[model samples]
Target: MALITLTSDIGQQDFLVSAVKGQLLQINPSFNIIDVTHQLSPFNYPQSAYVSRNAIKNFPDFTFHIVMVNLFERKPQQLLLAFHKNQYILCADNGLLTMILEEKPEMVIGLKLDSNAIKNTLYCAQIFGKTIKDISEGKSLLTIGEPDVPIIEKNHLRALLGDNWMEGQIIFIDNFENVIVNITRDDFEQQRRGRSFRIVFKRDEVIDKISESYADVSEGEKLALFNSAGYLEIAINKGNAAGLFGLQGYLEQTQNAYLQNRLFYQTVKVFFE
Candidate 1:
């Protein structure tokens, strides 16, 4: 059976998510549908990219991954079908493709939609279902859609680095309220150069060392550690780190007014000595 994974911001409160699955199954019963997540924060690209990138990399080759976050960032003209590292991704033509992959895909094709038809979530799923059906039947990528089409490109979120310091944005906050930063272990090590470091956030709170686990610290004490995904995480031993610290996830400001009133509440900075 072919594996198909779904990642979306559409919550399970209504029938929309299951209805999309029904559309796919109606077209091909052999597809083994998997749900990656249905609760991604709407319009939060960095969080979606972080989750989708990690999940897609672990799936077996030739798997089809569908991302439905921010599907209508603009009027939907066509969808993107990307093949990278032997797996397939189907998503909107929005700039999210580059954000998730963090680079160009091996191949990308624009899947056309009927202009006359009402463009909605279910209609989009129907188009994706037919395309997946065609590809599984061994249809060439060029035959299914237009090749070498121009796609919207967006840069991935990266940490700000300096000679003695690194500033990382809060990308995700887990169910337990552990705050995940954009900095990876490799980034920290290279910059540290065996020097002592202090992880600082929200102005006054500081952690002088990284812990291997939450239990390394006393209950309710703040600690920093590299998460399973290799990103830096700030947590309190059996407590809510984000809520207690008043840390917020990074948000992209769309207006100039928001930029003028900028605050680094969502940032964590590390200084090496």
Candidate 2:
């Protein structure tokens, strides 16, 4: 049985995920369906990308990955079936695939499915399922879909560095309220360079001092540390940092302005040195 993994924003409380699984099983009863995660934050591209990138390589070779987050956006009509490093990924033509592929794909075919014919997640069942089944049965990728357009390029998030400082935006915030910045451990170490530095968040809120581990600080105190994934994180030991500091991840000035007009809190800013 071929292993097909799913990663999506659809929560398990609803029938959306189960419905997709049912459809896939109907197509090939012997196919093994795995759920990498269904609790991904809604429309959170960076979080989804991080989880997908970390999870994909652990699965067996030839495993088919189906990404369904933000798939219905009216950006452009393009479907991506790509093979990289012996793994297959089926997703929309949006920049999601571009962020994950470490190297260029061997082939990228644009899939055109009869959108009107497939209802709901059945699009995946009919289109992606058929493709996976064919590949499992020893068919060429060229037989599935026609080439439509070359992959679109996207600008990556910027990382700015100075002699004694590095600036980066928060890329993800987990359920624990830990903030993961785009800056890596190497960036932090390079910027510190044997000098004392502090991490601040949300308009001069002294979120943390440098700490090697959570236990380095007293309970309820915030700390800046390198997480297991080698990313810099702002977290409160055994407490909710977001709630304590009234902070949310990745706020936009436009969104804050709308909120401020309604007597809500103003913008948030982060600084590190």
Candidate 3:
């Protein structure tokens, strides 16, 4: 029983997800299909990479993790199949593989599309489904397709520093409306260097210290903590922090500059004092 997982930006409102799943089942009825998520925001690769990276690690090794977000970033050229960290990942070659993995994979192959397959608008479903099927059927990874082609690179958001200040962008906003920043605990501490710091976001919301948990603050108060994923997160004790503070995620090539000005998405700033 081969396990396959799916994450996509295609909202659940349509039948595309079902059609894609059908393709998988048609190829192999014994496959165990798992839906990681289908509600990813459209073309938001950062969110896809963030969510998939955190969740996929928990799945059993050798499971196939397929990311179907932003498939049309360019044209539907080809699907990328890579074995990374003991698991297999199938996604578009449209720069997402670079965003999802920190380093190049031990194995990567491009599953080229046959002429008949490219005519369908949902070509991703066709190509990726077949690739997963072949692998599950004991197909040698090397025989799957060509290897070592140039994969597009995405510039991930990094915490910027200015002397005593570190400016970081929000990378994700969860269902609880907690804001996840690009700054990691290691990044924050390295920049802190023993100085006391104040994390400020929005207009005047300030958090002086990192908390162990959201419960560290009184209800309705804001708190900052290194989340289980090791990224700094801003959350209200029992409120919607993102909605209340009007903060959202921004990353490379995502939108306009992520800064404190009104023209762009707001960034979290830590001022060491």
Candidate 4:
């Protein structure tokens, strides 16, 4: 059976998610479809890339990831099929492929879309499904897709650094309302340089040390830790940190000054001392 994972921005409130899954199953009943997530915020590329990148790395090699986020960001000309680090990713050509992979894939192909086909989520799912089926049945990737195609490139979001401080954006807020920042462990350590640091967020809240786990702190006390995905996470033991702190996830909004101030408040700043 082929292992296929689905990630999308479509919420679970409607039938579209299930309909897309049905379309995939219709193409290959033997496919083992896994849902990474469907509740990702729309057009939030940083959050999508973070979740997709972390989840894709955990799956076994050869796993097919079908990303249905931002499918109609532009007129659909082609879908991207990328083979990176022994895994396959199918996503819209909206620069998400590069963001998730953080680099060029080992190999990439452009799966052309039919101009006449109703360019909906289900149709795109069908196109991806058939391509996976063909590859599973010994079809050469190059034969079915246009190789060496130029794809849209978008850089991964990174922390903004100063001489003594680095600022990170809140990328995700989980079910428990713990906030995940974009700063990775590697980034944190390299910047720390063995100095004591303080993580400041929401203008006034602060965490001075990185804890091993949420349990390291008293219940309802805020703590900072490197999450399983190796990103910086701020949580309160058995409490809702995001809600309590009023920490909102980062959004790339630049239009309104009010939203810009809100975005600034959402950032977590680490000062090395």
Candidate 5:
């Protein structure tokens, strides 16, 4: 049986996910439906991208993963389906695809659904269900829609550097309240070669010193470190870093908020003595 995975901001408190599953089963009863995650922060694309990126590769090859966060954000009312590194992914064409792909897709196709025929989350049942059914039945992607507009490709987040610092805003706050920055560890380490740097949250609170592990600091002590996924993380040992630091992850707007009782970090200066 072909496996289909679902990830979305749709909370489990409702019947959204079940309805999608029902639609899939109706189309192809023998197919397997898996849930990667349903607790994603609402409309948070970076979090969705990060979670999907880490999760998709673990599934078997030929798995179809669907991400349905913020499907109505942009125009053209389209969805994205692509195959990358032996996995198939379906999501809105917002930067989510580009963020995860990190490069051009092996095969990229846009899915044009009858917006009128399928409205609300129920559309996943109708549109996505039909797509998956077709694919399992040996239908080509080109059979779904006409050659539509090309996909928009761009990096939504910024990378931090040692010699040249790039500003990155917090893009996600997971349920654990760990703030996920737009900056990746690679860019941070490349620019920070042994220089002392600081991460400032709201009210000018500075977090200095990178820890080798979460246990490197005593209980209630905050530390900056590279997470297992190789992303720079700001966390407190056995405590809530976001609560202690009053840091807000994923800002809705970027303005002088940095100046208004907000956190700001000095540019990481890299100098070889």
Candidate 6:
């Protein structure tokens, strides 16, 4: 049986998700549908990419990973079907494909309107459902539509290098409220060069050393660690660090042109001695 994984900004509360699955079953009843997450923050590309990147690799090869977040970014007329590392990924052309994959996919094909089994559809479920049905049935990607089309590009904020300091930003806050920083462990070690450093964020909150787990600190104490994704994470032992520290995930400001200059929601600086 073919496995299909789904990740979407659409909350699990409504019947819309089920309706899409029902359509898939109507076309291919043998498809093994699994969900990565349906609680994604709406249109938050960084968060979507973060979760998608971390989760998709665990599944076996040949899984059709469907990402349904921010489907209508300025009303994209086409959807993306990409083959990368022996697996298939589908999503909107919302500049997130570049951010999520880091590199160009091995092959990419755009879904065509003619391939859509349902016409004049407004919701993503209707359009994507039909295209995915065609895909599951051995339809050639060449027959799908245009190939190697220009993908929208977007880059994440990187840790800024300084003489005795590295500036980073909060990339994501997990369900555990652990604040994931943009600084990877390799980046920190390279910049540290064997010097002592302090991670300073919000006012008066500081973590001096990296811990392996929450138990490394006492209950209710602040600790910093590198998460599974290899990014620096700050958390309070058995507590909600984001709420206590007033730190937030990266929020892209797309409405106001002037606000685009300032990108990140919260920033953390590591000062070394």
- Candidates' lDDT values, in order? 0.92, 0.70, 0.82, 0.93, 0.70, 0.80
**Inter-residue clash pairs, candidate 5:** 162-191, 201-263
**TM-score per candidate:** 0.96, 0.81, 0.92, 0.98, 0.82, 0.88
Candidate structures ordered by TM-score, highest first? 4, 1, 3, 6, 5, 2
Across 172-263, the per-residue lDDT of candidate 2 in tens digits comes to 67788877776777867666776666565665666435678999999987788878777777888998876776655443233455465432
Which portions of model 5 show Cα errors greater than 4 Å? 74-76, 147-149, 160-167, 194-196, 203-208, 252-273
Q: lDDT by residue for model 6 over 1-273, one digit each (tens)?
A: 678898888888978778767776776788789988889888777778888877788889877888888876665667888989988888888888777787778999887554444432234555566666777688887877689887777875567899899988777888888898878899999999999999888757778999999999999999999988888999999999888888887666554776554443377889999
Clashes of each: 0, 0, 0, 0, 2, 0
lDDT of 2 at 20: 83
Error of 4 at 54 (Å): 0.7
User: What are the per-residue Cα lDDT tens digits for candidate 3 across 1-273?
Assistant: 789998988888988889888887887888798998999888777777788888788899899998888887786666789898889998888877767776677788988887665535366676777787888789998898888666776755577898899998787898899999888899999999999999988867889999999889999988999999899999999899989988877745544454435423458899998
lDDT of predicted model 4: 0.93
Sort the candidates on lDDT, descending order. 4, 1, 3, 6, 2, 5
**Ten residues in a row with the worst lDDT in model 5?**
264-273
lDDT of 3 at 60: 90
Clashing pairs in 4: none
User: Model 6: clashing residue pairs?
Assistant: none
Candidate 4 structure quality by residue, lDDT tens digits, 1-273: 889999999999989999999999999999999999999999999999999999999999999999999999999889999999999999999999988988988899999989888999999999999999999998999998999799999988889999899999999999999999999999999999999999998778888999999889898899999999999999999999989998888877544865866776678999999
> Best-fitting candidate, measured by TM-score?
4
